[model samples]
Target chain A: MDPKVVNDWRLRGQRYRLEGELCDHCGEAIFPPRDICPKCHEPAKTPQTLSGRGEVYTFSTIYSAPEGFEAYTPYTVALVKLEEGPIVTAQLTDVPPAEVQIGMPVEMVTRRLRTHGEEGTIVYGYKFRPASFWHASTQA
Target chain B: MSSQHLMQPERAVGIIGYGSYIPMYRLSSTEVARVWSGGGRGPIKEKAVAGLDEDTVTIAMEAARNAVARAEIQADALRAIWVGSESPPYAVKPASTLVAEALGATPYLLAADFEFACKAGSEALQAALGLVGSRMGDYAMAIGADTAQGRPGDDLEYTASSGGSAFVVGPADLAVATLLGSLSYATDTPDFWRRAYQHYPRHGGRFTGEPAYFHHTQSAASRLMEELGMDPDDFEFAIFHQPNVKFPSRAARRLGFTAEQIDTGLLSNLIGNTYAGASLTGLSAVLDVAKPGDRILLVSFGSGAGSDAFVWEVTERITSRQDKAPRVTDYIRRRTEIDYALYVRYRGKLKT
Candidate 1:
C-alpha cells in the first residue's frame, strides 16, 4: 500500500521523528530508555531524540490481510531492535518481501497506514531500511 | 445463632436496587449449530445475539438503568461504578464511565473495570462488598454483560449469550442481602483462553470440566461450607457459573448436592451462558423464588485463575422489595425471538 498519502496527515509539517530518551538525575542520552538512572530514584524522565536506526531482530510475511492492502497482501512486518533498546514493530517499507534478513540495518521512515476511502485522516508510523548513513561509525 | 456474634451491626450494603437486560432476541442452539455446521453434537441447541449497536457497553447501561430504577436511587448516589466483562468495547477507553454517564453517576465516582474471564462479575461483587463494608459508600454498582462471540465454525458460538445484571452493594437495613462469608482460590493454568482475538474464549474441549470448573468450584464451595458452617442440605437455592447447562448439574452431583438441590440452576439451558452475568443472573432467578432467611450459596470460576464461594442471607428487605426488580422468569420469558439470518446480523457475523 502507498504510504505517501496516508502518512501525509501525521507527518504534515515534520518529516523527522524524535525517537530518543531524555534523562532525569543528569541530562543524558540513553537508547532504549534505561529503567533507572543507575543512580537516583527521581523517577522524572523526559524523552530524548535520536536518529531512528536499528537492526532487524525478526520478520514475518503477512500472507493474509484485511481488505485495503489487497495489493500488499504478502507484505512484510518486522521488529527492528533500535540501538536505543526499544524494539519497534513496523511495516518493512522500501524493501521486497524476499530480501528481508535478520541483522539487516533499518531506519525510520514516516508512512501512512489505512484509508477511510474519502478525505479521512490516514494512520501514520515508522518504517525501516538498509543503512547508508554518511558516517560509518553510525552503525553502532 | 453462634455466627450472629461474628455479624456486626454494620450497615448491610445490599441491592437496594437490581436491574437486568436481555436483548429482546433469542436463537435456538439447534438453529445456530445447524446453520454454522451440518451436524455436530455441539453448543448443540441455542444462544442470545445482540444488535450491532449493542456491544457490552449498551447492554450494561440498559441493565444499569433498570437496576437504578429498581433501587430508586438517582444515578448521582452511585459512588463507584465497576464493570466486569471479558469483552470490553474498547481496549483503551473505560466502559464504566460511559455506563456512569447514562445512569447519571457522579463524574468523579470511582470508575473501574475487571476481567477474570467468566468470574469477573462475581469477583467484582466480592470486591464491592469489601469496599462498602469499609464505608467506601452507602452503595456501589457492579455490572456484568457480554456478547461473547466465537469463530464462525467454533463450538462456543452457541452458548455465548448476551445479557447484563447490576447489583447495588451497600449496608444492613438498606441491604437486600448480606454477604455472610466468602472463600476463593487462584491457580494459573490455561484451561481456556482466546489468543487470536477473532474468536470467543477457547477451552481445551472438556478440559475445563475436570481441571478448571469442577476442581475450582469444589475447592471454593468446600471452603465456604467450612467457613460458614453450612451443609449442602441447608441451602434453598445454589447457583453456579454455567459454561453449558450440563456443567452445574454435574458439579452438583460431585459435591453431593441432589438433582433437586441445584434446581434453580436449571434456567441456563434456556438462556445460554451469559458469561459474566451467567451465575449472577442465575442468582437473580433464585432470588425470585427465595424467602427471608433463605440462604443461597454461590460459586464462580474464571479460567486462567480461580473460583469464589459466597453465602448470602436473604433478609425481609429482599421480599418486601421483591416487586422492585423484575422477576427472573418474567425477564426470561419476555424475549424477542430472531431467525438465524437476523441472528447473524445482530451478531455482526454478516458482511455489510
Candidate 2:
C-alpha cells in the first residue's frame, strides 16, 4: 500500500466522523465533501456533521474479499442513505451479512479497515451497525 | 481521614455517564468444544468476536460516543482521554489519541493508553478520578476495551472475548453515580502474561487461581470494606472481575455477598470474559437498574496479580441518563450466534 494513500486517508478523518458539507443554497447534504455542491453546482459553504444515523439503501455480501480483507470473507457492504441526505457506502458491522436489509436503520461506528502488516500502517474507517440493536428491547 | 491512607481523591468524582459496546457476533463454547473434541464441553455460553474491521480502537470509539450522549456534555468538555486495552490496535501508538480524535476531543487534552491485563480500564478510571476531582479537568473519559486473544485449544480461548465500556468522569455533584472511595492492591505475582511480540498470553493454569484472581480480588474488596467501615450486607450490588462464571460467583460468596447481590452484574456467563472491559461492563449493567441511593461495590482483578475496588452510590441524576445510551443488557441480548468456522474467520485465525 502507498504511504500516500494512508496519508490521504488522514486528510479525510472527518469523513470517518460523519462530518460533511451542507449546501446552503440548495439545502443538500454532501458527504466525502466537496468545495462545490453536486446538487446546486455552487460552493456548499456550510459545514455539517451528520447525525450518524441512516438506513441501508442497498447491500451485498462479499464472499471473496479484496486484498488484506480476505479474512473477513462473506462480509456485508452497504450503501447507507444518511438521515441528512447523502448516500455513503460503508461496510456493515455487528450484524451478519445475511441480516442486512434495505431500509434497515443503522448508525456509524469507527473501526479498523485494514493493516499493511504486523509492522505496517493500519487504516481505520467508519462502518455501520444496526441502530435497532441498541434500542430494540430497551425502549420503554 | 488518616494522613496515611490509600490513593483516593479528596473531592468526590464518579461516572457522570457511561456506555458499552459488544460486537453482535457470538461463538458458543459448544461450537469451540466441538472443534477440539468430538462433542460438547466448555466453561461459558458464548463469547463476542470483533469483526474484521473492529478492534479496541473502534470499540472504544463507539463506547465513548454513547458515553458522551449519556453525559449530555460536549466531547470538547473532556480534558483527558485514557484507554485501557491489552489488545490496542498499535503497540507503540496510543489508542487514546485516535479515540479522542474520533469523538471530536482533540487539539487540547491529555491522552494515553494503559495495559494491566484485565483491570486496565479501572486503572484509567482511577486517573480520571484524580483529574476531575483535582479540578484539572471538568470532565475526563476513561475507557476499558479489548479484543482479547487466547491460544488455540487453550482454556482461555473459551472465555477470551471482545467488548468495551466507557465512563465519563466528572464531579460527583453532577455525577450519575458518586464515587465514595476506591483502593488498589497490586503485586508482581505473574499469574498471566504475554511477552512482547507474543501472539497469546501464557497462564499458570490452576496457579491463576488462589494466588492471582482470588487473592487480589478478595484483598481489594475486603480492604475497601474495612477502610470504609462497610460490609457486604451494606451494599445493594457487587461486581467482581469475572474471568469465568465460577471465579466471580465463588469470590462473591466467599466475600459474604449473596447471589442476588452479584447476579445483575454477572455477564461473563453470557458474553464471556472481556478482559479489560469485564468488570466495568458488569458495573454498567448494575447501574442500568440501580435505584437512586443504592450502594454498589466494584472490584476488578488483573492478572499481573492486582485489583482495584470502588464503592459507588447511585444518584437521582442516573435516571435521566440511563436512557441516553443503550443498556448493557441490550448489548447482551442482541447477539447472533456463529459457528466455529466463522469464528475463526472473524478472529482472523486463518493463515494468510
Candidate 3:
C-alpha cells in the first residue's frame, strides 16, 4: 500500500483504547488528545492513555430520529461515569434496552455508529456493549 | 390524612406545587455544532449548556424555590429532599443538601441523589410521594437538574441544555399537583452509561434505538397503563423523558401517542436536554396549563435498569395559586447566540 495514498486508519485509536494528553501541570487529561495543557494554562503536556474500561453511571434510550441518525432511530444514549470521575455520554449497546441495568458492568468496544452519506468514510469510535461480549466475539 | 373522596384519583400524589430556574446567559446549538464540526452540522442549530462555574445543585435550588414560592405548604413540612441527575457536580458529597438549604427546607429531612439517565427526576418524584403518602414523611421535595454534554461532532452535543425543575409534595390544599397512581419496570443490561472517572462516555449507536429506549419506555409505560386499565388516550397531558427535540416525538408516535399529545415536547427541542431534568421539565411545561380537574401522567425511563411512572390529578389548589411558571418557551426562544468557537470553550473541548 502506498505510504500516504491508502488510508492507514487502524481498527482502533492510538491504542486498543483512547489516547489523551494530560497536563502534567494541571492534572487535566485531554482526550482525542492535545499537546498543551489547557487547564494548567501551560503549553506543556505529556501523552497518556486509558483502558476504555468503565461503568455506566447513568444513561437514556433515545427513541427518535435526528438528521444524520435516521437509520438508527431509537437508540440508547448513555452518560458513562469513567473510573476517572469524568462522565462521558455514548450510545449503549449489546444488552437490550429492556435489560439495561443501572450500575451494570460495561466495557469499551470499537463499533460503527454510521457512515457518512456524501463521503463514504466510516466514523468509528468507542461504544458500550454487554460485559459478556468483553472477550467473546461470536465471529467463531 | 388519607383522602377517599378525591375526585381525580389518577394523580393522588399530585405535584402540589412546582418551580424552575435558568441562568441569565445562554448558548445556542448552532454555536455548539460549529465548534466541534469544524464549522457546523449543515443547517444545524446550537443548544444551550451551562457554564463551568455553575453545577446541578445551583440550578436545582433555583427551581425548587419557585415550586415552593406559590405553594400552600411550608418548607418545614417537607420530610425528604431528592436531587435527580446524571451530571451531579460532586461525586462524593450529596447535592440534595445544597438544594435543600437553598430552598430553606428542614435539615432533618432525608436527602439523596437519584440516578437513572434522564428519568431520575420523575423517579425521584414518585419515590418522594411514596415517602410522604405512605406516612414515612409529611411532605417531600423532588428536584431534577443537569448540564448534559456530548462530544462536539456528536449529535447529542448540540441538543443538550442546562436547567432544572422542582416539585413540593404534601397533604395540603390544592396548589400542588396531586399524585394518584404509579407504576414502573426494568431490564438488567447496559443500554447507555459512563464510568465514574471518564471525561466522556461510550455508547452502542444502533442498539440504543427502539430496542433500548422505545421498547423499555413503551413496554414499562404500556404495562403501567395496562395495570391501571387505562389507554394511551386517557390523559390530557403526557410527559416523557426527553433526550433531544427529535427523540420524545418519535418515541411517542412509536408508542401510539399522537403529535398533539407529544407536541409539548417542544420544551426539550427549545431548551436542550437537561440530563435528569429533561422529561420532568416537559411535565413542568405541561403543568403550566393543567387545570385542577385535569389528569396527567408522568413517565421516566433510565437506561441500564428501567422506568418510574406516576399518574397525577391536577387540583383546585393549583388554580387558587397564581401561575408562576417561567414560560420555558420564552426562555428557549430567547437566544443570546454564540459562535462555534465560544461553545468549544464552554465545552472545554478545545483546550486553549
Candidate 4:
C-alpha cells in the first residue's frame, strides 16, 4: 500500500465527481468538504454532487510546468466558478491556451492527471473543457 | 454447431440510450506520410487522437455520462458497467472500476473489462443485453473506447485512432432500439495480436482480410439473418467493424447489402480505426438519424477471429431521446488538427 494511493483514494469523491458538502444551516456550498460549515460555523455533513458546469473566473497559462507535467507545458489553469456557487481551481483541457477566455463556459470531464513513472497508479480526476453553447443552453 | 450460436435473451431488451466521444485532436494521414514515407498520403483522410490527459478510462467516462444523460436514469441504477478497450492505460488494473466509481455506480455494481480486439465493444453490449434481459438488472451500461496505438512508421499508424461509444441497455418497452436477436461466430485464426508487455500490435496483413475479418463477419451476419429469416432488403442501415475504409464495403456487398445501407454508418474514413470503438461508433452515427421502424444490422469483427452480428429495430422513443446528448456527428465536426510532432508526443511515441 502506497501512501499516495491511499491519499488519492480518500479524496476520490471530490476529485472524480465533484462531491461537495452543502451547509444545512446556511445553504452555502462547500468544496473539499471539511465537515464544518464555513458560513454559519456549524456542523455540516450533507453530501451534494455538483452539476460540473461553470464559468472561468480567471486563468493562467503555464509555460514552465512541474516535473511530471512537463509534457503538457503551456497548459491553462483556471479558477472556475461552479454553477453551484463554489469556485474550484483546476486544469483546463481540450482547449487551446490562446482561446481560453475569462468568462468562457466550461464543463467537467474526467482526465488523467499524471502517473507515477511507468508502474505506478495513474491518477484520474476532473478537468474542465470549453462547453458548447448549444450544450450549455440545453443543460440550462 | 447446428444451432449456429444464435442467442436471444429470455426477456426482450433494447438500447435505452446511446452516446459517443471523439477526442478533440485530429492527425491527418498526410502528416504520417510526410514524416515517415517522405511523401504521398496514407489510407484514410485523418484520425482522432486523445489529448495529453485523455485515455481509455477518460473516454469511457465521458461516453458513459452522455449515455446516462440520454437514458435519464440515475447512475446508481446501473447494475453493470463494462468497458472494452484494446489500449487500457493499465495492463493489470481494471479500467471499468474507475469508470463505475466516477459514474456513481459503485459498491454494488458489477464492473469489468473485456478484450476481444475490435469487437470488444459489441461483446460488452451482448453481455449487457443478457444482463438486463435476464432480469438480473434493470439497467446496464456497455462502453467501447480506445486510445489505440501503432508503431511509429507502421501502416497501422495511419488508421489506429482514438474514440469510443456507449450504450445503456434496459427493458424493451423503454428502448430507443429493441434488440431482436444476435449471433456470434469465432475461430482460432490469429489475424492480429500484441503479446504481453508489447507496446504495439502486429497484424497478419493480407491474412486479416479473407480468412479472419471477412470469414467471421460474413459467417455471423449470414447465420443471424438466416436464422431470423431476414435479408439485406429488410434493414434500413448496416454497420460493420471498420479497420479501414474498404473492408466494411466489401463485407456488406458480399453479404447482399447495398452501398446505401452501409453509407450512413461508415465512419472509419473520418475517424480511422478505433478498434473496439469502431462498429459501436458507427452504430451511434446511425442511431443519430434513424427513424422509427427502421431495422439495422450490425456486424463487428475482432482480430482474435470473432464477429458479433445483431438485429436492431428502432422504436418511436428514438425521436425524443436523440437530442438528450451530443450527437456523433457533432463530435466529428468538432476537431483540431495537430502535426506529427505533437501526435507522437501526445501518444508517447517518443521516449521522454
lDDT (tens digit, per residue) of candidate 2 on A31-118: 8778799987988867677888999999999998888887666789989999888899898877767778899999988878777767
The docking category that best describes candidate 1 is incorrect
Interface RMSD of 1: 27.5
Candidate 1 on B269-294: residue-level lDDT in tens?
Answer: 77788888888777777766778888
Q: lDDT for model 3, on a 0 to 1 scale?
A: 0.65
lDDT of candidate 4 at residue B8, scale 0 to 100: 92
Write down the C-alpha DockQ for each prediction.
0.01, 0.69, 0.01, 0.58
* Candidate number with the higher TM-score (3 or 4): 4
When 2 and 4 are scored with lDDT, the better candidate is: 4
Can you write out model 2's per-residue Cα lDDT over B115-175, one digit (the tens) per residue? 8999999999998999998989899999999999999899999999999999999988889
Cα misplacement distance, residue B71 of candidate 1 (Å): 2.3
- Candidate 4 deviant stretches above 4 angstroms: A133-140
- Measured against the true structure, the TM-scores of the candidates, in listed sequence, are 0.68, 0.95, 0.66, 0.97
Better of 1 and 2 by DockQ: 2
DockQ-based CAPRI category assigned to the predicted complex of candidate 3 = incorrect
Tens digits of per-residue lDDT for model 3, A1-140: 53321332442333224555667776876665556765667865575555456787877877775765555545677776666544567777534577777787676543445545543443445566555431232222
- Number of the candidate with higher DockQ, 2 or 4: 2
Measured over all alpha carbons after superposition, the RMSD of each candidate to the real structure, in angstroms, is 18.7, 2.1, 19.7, 1.7
What lDDT score is found at residue B207 in candidate 2? 95
> How well docked is model 2, in DockQ terms?
0.69
Flag regions of model 2 displaced more than 4 Å: A5-9, A24-27, A63-66, B1-4
